[model samples]
Target: MLEAVVGLLLMLLGVSHGVETYCDGRQDGAQCYGALGGTVVLQLMDNTSGISRYQWSIKTTTTTTTIIRWTNNMIVINAIANRSSFTPSDGTFRINNLIWTDGGEYELEIFDSDGNISEKRTLQLTIQAAGYLPIMAGVLSALVILLVFGVAVVCAQKKKQNNKPKEKEDHELTYADVRTVQQPVRQMQKKAETEVEVEYGQVKFPERPQQTVEPA
Candidate 1:
């Protein structure tokens, strides 16, 4: 009975150690895209359990270069010519100012305190030219909106100017709008007659009649 129990325990241990390790770039189609002179970060997706050290390296077609080696509370640079950083607590690695030559397969190895590799992750990194279409499109859209607004304002001003002459012409008054002209004559046979004229638009006329008469 004790032998059977030991055999079951050994089988469970083997099964536990046989679990596969998987790597993901957290990007579309499991590919990481980077730009020239930009920063690239490789993040660990697994939960931090018994991790003690981190090893980051880049594999090119003809060479494999170690970038960083990090242990708990310690960090070491292996590639002195390249700018790289490592966070040991989280097993995260960062590369600064990527160039065209930086494009390669990046490998990350997490080890326990016993120097045994606990997990390994590899991701392909590609560096390409930076994109500027979004920024240029935004600038062009703002320019177009401003141009349309300016044109609308100019058209409104021109329309107002054009309507001014027609308004003035349509507002002209005829002779019937004014009060009628009348003359008052007194009983003097030889005096010359005096007349008064009234105008439109609020001009006051004389109330008293002049004492002049026309010859009968």
Candidate 2:
């Protein structure tokens, strides 16, 4: 479809037009956005020939700090703005290593040739901490993958244990087996010895003894 092709082309090409700047101070009261821990470039003015001195300050809710102050002859960048650079010819200010505390209103005081205030412009700058989400997501994904791999390894070990062959049991002898191994009596005695003799007899009685007893 046409939409898909357009989307692919947009991805292949970049989002930049001729120049990229956090804020443009061509007019007064401009607003700018910068990413946290990133860099921001500002176009302060079209030309810096008429300006004698340029003083830039950032104002927060509680305090205000001078970031950079420069003149046509000498340029002095503050310690807090150590990573910042400015071009006097084109009035472009580039700041690096942005933080959350850097979000506030910035005031640029421009002085004329006679040391008179020519223009005092204030621009609102907001810093977004949007660069860390992708990092956090990637770490979470890696941890999830490691956990899944560990679980799979443990499951594989258990399956290997289940599929392994069992060992054979030892064969021990029982009481019945011991009895069968002993020798049994092959034959009994044919006759037993007699300790005493047994006897059988027959007796006859006289008849005369009965007649003598009748006379008496």
Candidate 3:
């Protein structure tokens, strides 16, 4: 677990140890490393007080870019060298957000106030996709282990849920709807208060005479 964590941090942080590169210019000083999208700090000189002017440039196969230069006590950072900073006090040049193209040999030229040549030094920098691969085998192993552990946890949870028996469905109840309709009641309307009930008698007329027509 610790190894996995360390590997992950290395891959993410791009953390690497920097060797103290002096202004010897004799030894091709040990190489420094910068991680992609990371930062790198290079020590150019011990003291800036002795140096009246200095220039730093990185030489790559395709092109050479001036990272920073100081002259007449004025510091001028190259327009192309973005995210690069230099401190006159410590003579340290820091570059952030490194890219693959930044890998190259860096050279420093120091001059005195009298325009006299001083000492020169050079250092190499390597750009890696990750912080340290040989140390941790990159981030692949850690990611794989994490992925496997996550999948196992998911499978275990699914198995637990499947093992739990579903409760039997409750019996469905049948229902019959009953409805009653009421007959309408007739309402009598009131007329005049003195209106009496009138009754009509049946009139019957007796047969006047059974008149037979005499045969004349």
TM-score of each: 0.51, 0.51, 0.52
After superposition on all C-alphas, the RMSD of every candidate to the true structure, in Å, is 21.2, 19.2, 18.1
Q: What is the C-alpha lDDT profile of model 3 across 8-64, one tens digit per residue? A: 867644544321222222235647777766677777776578567888778877876
lDDT, candidates in the order shown: 0.60, 0.67, 0.64
- Model 1: colliding residue pairs: none
Off by over 4 Å in 1: 1-30, 35-41, 45-49, 78-102, 112-118, 128-131, 173-216
* Regions of model 3 farther than 4 Å from truth: 1-30, 60-65, 130-216
At residue 6, give the lDDT of candidate 3.
63
lDDT computed for candidate 2: 0.67
Colliding residue pairs in candidate 2: none
Stretches of candidate 2 exceeding 4 Å from the true structure? 1-21, 25-27, 46-50, 60-64, 77-79, 152-216
Q: After best superposition, candidate 1 residue 31: deviation in angstroms?
A: 1.9
> Which is the winner by lDDT between candidate 2 and candidate 3?
2
Over all chains combined, what TM-score does candidate 1 have? Answer: 0.51
